[model samples]
Target: MTDTPIFQPGDALASARRTLLTEAQAIETLAARLDDAFAEAVRLLLACRGRVVVSGLGKTGHIGRKIAATLASTGTPAFFLHAAEAVHGDLGMLTAQDVLIALSHSGASQELLTVLPAVRRLGAKVIAITGNPQSELAQLADIHLNGAVDQEACPLNLAPTASTTAALALGDALAVACLEARGFGPEDFARSHPGGALGRRLLTHVRDVMRQGGAVPRVPLSATLFQALEEMSAKGMGMTVIVDDANRPAGIFTDGDLRRLIERRGDLRGLLAAEGMSRNPRTIAAEALAVDAAAQMDEQRLSQMLVVGKQGELIGALHMHDLMAAKVV
Candidate 1:
């Protein structure tokens, strides 16, 4: 076994800083080197009717996988195909309408070079990302993106460090440019990521997390304060909706109103729900988003909101707790 040298804390930190600075500079240099070729590549990808197929080997393969994911999530149809695997039979995944993005630092990866003729014969256009502009892969490509970097961050300057960073940054720029050019909005993004937070906020409606029918606390306006309290206690919503004979919400009575009533009247035996209730309670449509409801509640300093229909009749109720339970808040 070889003896290892112990690194001091400062030595480790300094090394990390240098690595970051080197990678950052590599991306900066790549940005400065961008030309009409970058725009042409973007146009090629944007015009593709079929999927984008990214192919690479070694560390470049890992970056290719991430690039494919970013492209897919940002509205571009894309997937990764291992260059070595392509020769083994996976090349069948390629189609005439597809666009192939080939990655190689030296631009001479044997597996990629071997599959190039087959890809061309299949009629798919090629975009090569390489450090060597004069290499065979770059020369054969329909559009070549120069991803050259000054040096690697490796101590020996041999490991794939800064080169990979530059390549990944270039991939991200392509994905984002395609996304913007397509006019992809948040709603479009949310559709692609239904399990994410933004998806829940945009897709989940109030009816999905509201208390309906018997579960909602409600009472007639003619009911005594005692009856409203009974309904509130049974439903556990901290408040009760006071509706008229047609079942339209006339007012709302909460715990705060009860306390205020007791302080003012001193005797609540004959007080009716209508007299104690707060008039013109805030209402939200059952079809609205739960996040929008939460925003309305926050704006009004309310813990609960009445859900009404097109005819302004009470249909359901929503509490802040309901939104929390649904993970929409």
Candidate 2:
């Protein structure tokens, strides 16, 4: 267990609020400074045939790497290269088809200055993100993005706090603009992130994860309790859909229904499924997203649901465990 701190909660809370407000104001300032240059940078990136190459130094380099990643994941092909290494023959990565986004808060990093001319000569356009608009980098680049901040969130105003935030926000703005301009949709995002749970949520459908045909555990409405129990045990999904003569679901029988019937009558030897099953059980469509099915299960506090078609015919069954195995949850 952790011990209590020396400072009072009220004082600490006040300081935290001040820090957040400071960064908010800094972002507001950057937003106001955004101009036609921002749009021009967007246009340059959009027209580029090759990849986007991002470079920076130290903390600004960290921000650049993240910016590059965001851009790539959002359908803009991009990668990061260290500014210091660019001068040491790393410049071979550049070509006329590529675009370079150089990040330097001061716009005076020696390493970036050393390679800017070479990158330009190689025919790759440069977009400089710098706080000092008059600095060499901003002056030399084809387009200058004004990432200036009023002050750092630090009390000493020496660390790269608010400045980095402004740069990151601006980078995010550019990536989103590019994403929208290209009409990149969720399906495209899923393709980019296929290994994560988010990918399963966006890419998977109920039909893909549902148990269909003979795999679906179901019994007729007239099936006896013993018969329904046998089907549920055989399927091992802990529930069975009770269907009518036309193969449409009229009700459902689950382990919970068995427990309730046992408590109410203390015996179910001669009971039929229609006598004990819950009528009008909620259902989901087979065409729905698997994540939507998970949401419905959680919302209804159920472990399984009958999957049906638009015509109210039983097509399959979806279980909570299926969603778990598919990583939709």
Candidate 3:
């Protein structure tokens, strides 16, 4: 029988770290290799009227999915279509207006090559990303991007380690370039990813989540403290807006105010709303983005903010709870 190899803890850990560094280096090399072809690919995708369809097999499929997601989220409309599935009628997803980016390290994935004729017949331009420029797929493509790696991180040199990572990084580069070329902004990204964290940060404006007029509890300066409590109870907003004679927001009275007033055994009926309400309450603009409001609230340690117009009129009110539900917090 063959002898079993001895394991050294330090040696094994060091080897793994070296492999990770090698993968990182592969990505950097791919970045340096980018040329006019990368720009041409971006232009082809932006000119597409339908979508960018990414196809791959094996580990390449995993990277393809991520690349498609990044492209879609960043403004380039794209989706992943398994090479095997394309032969099984999924090819219907592609159209003349679409562009196809096929991924394969060897550039000889059987499923991919089988659909090349149909892909061309549909008038869809194919961009091949592979390690071999002389491969059949590369020769068939309208454009080819070289994603070669000198060696893999795997000691056996059999696993797709450094090569797959390089491909993924290259895909990200393409996505970002296309995003910039399209002038896609945060608002566009938000629209594409409405359920994601980025959407909450960019699309959730103050007007969408803020409590509006009539729903906001408020009382005149001449009203008694007992009257403010009744208003707060009825509105269920946990606070009452204090407005000036011109209906401008003066300050606010909250649950904390109630606690302080209660601690002093203050006269609930005798005190006026102007006396009990805070005069320098935190406020935000009705047009302010939710992200900015969240930052302001965190910096000031305030639980809620009064939304006002340019004239300081009480337009709406926002609570920390609204931000929490919107996932902006």
Candidate 4:
């Protein structure tokens, strides 16, 4: 049976700290080593007519996958191709207009080396990221990015720890530079991530969530307070909009208003909706973003908002509960 190492909390903590420090230092060193070659690499990627293909093996391959995803999400067309897969038949995925980013910390991965000549013959440019500047991969590449680290963070100084961290940081720097150069913004990002929260906030419109047609709680301005209360109860929005003959919103009456009116006057006698309602209520365009509507509600401390059309006519109603149900809150 193989003996397991004894568990020592102190030693484990020390090792963890050392690993973090080593990886952090590796990234710092990579940043300091950036030169005109990095700019040229970014230019090459930007000028490419086709997609960016990233390839690597083992631990570096994992890093390459993440880099490709970052590039793709940030408005650069990119994908990852495993080095071993490329040597087999996946090289066909490459086109003359494409740019290849090959990762090999040793700068001598056999799989990458085997695919390099064919990639070159296909008329695609190559960008190599390796720890050794004098390595054959670096020499063969059209542009070389130095990802060299002082040492690995492993206790034995053998495993790829600090080196992988450096490579990832360098890849991230390249992606961010391309993103900024392309003027990629939150809207563009949201388009690519439609299933995420930011996409919901940006893409969902007030009309998409606001209650429309007969669902909206509304009444004529000349209606009695009891009639307005009936409309609010039927719509279940805790509020009712009072509109004029033109269907333009004249005022709003809420449960809070009803409570205050009863507390002040204590009379259930002939009160018009106009006399009981609050005038000049807040209204939003149906085309406005739901997140914007949410923001307005928060700023005004409102539980409900009226939706209006271009001609100041009532079209729908929006409530805080609707925003909550849509997850736009």
Best by lDDT: 1
Per residue, candidate 4 scores C-alpha lDDT tens digits across 106-221 of 99999999999999999999999999999999999999999999999997889999999999999999999999999999999999888889999988999999999999988997
Clashes of each: 0, 0, 0, 0
lDDT of each residue in 75-154, candidate 1, tens digit only? 99999999999999999999999999999999999999999999999999999999999999999999999999999999
TM-score of each prediction? 0.97, 0.78, 0.85, 0.97
The candidate 4 region of ten consecutive residues with least summed lDDT is: 268-277
Q: What is the Å distance of residue 165 in model 1 from its true position?
A: 0.2
Candidate 1 to truth, TM: 0.97
For all candidates in order, the CA lDDT equals 0.96, 0.93, 0.90, 0.94
lDDT of 3: 0.90
The C-alpha RMSD in Å for every predicted model, in order, reads 1.3, 4.9, 3.3, 1.3
Q: Give the per-residue Cα lDDT of candidate 4 at 156.
A: 86
For 1-329, candidate 2 gives per-residue lDDT tens digits of 35976778999899889889989998999989999999999999999999999999999999999999999999999999999988888889888999999999999999999999899889999999999999999999999999998888888999899999999999999999999999999989998998876788898999989999999999998899999999999999998999999889999999999999999988778899888899987888888999999998999898998888888999999889998988899
Worst 10 residues of 2 by lDDT: 1-10
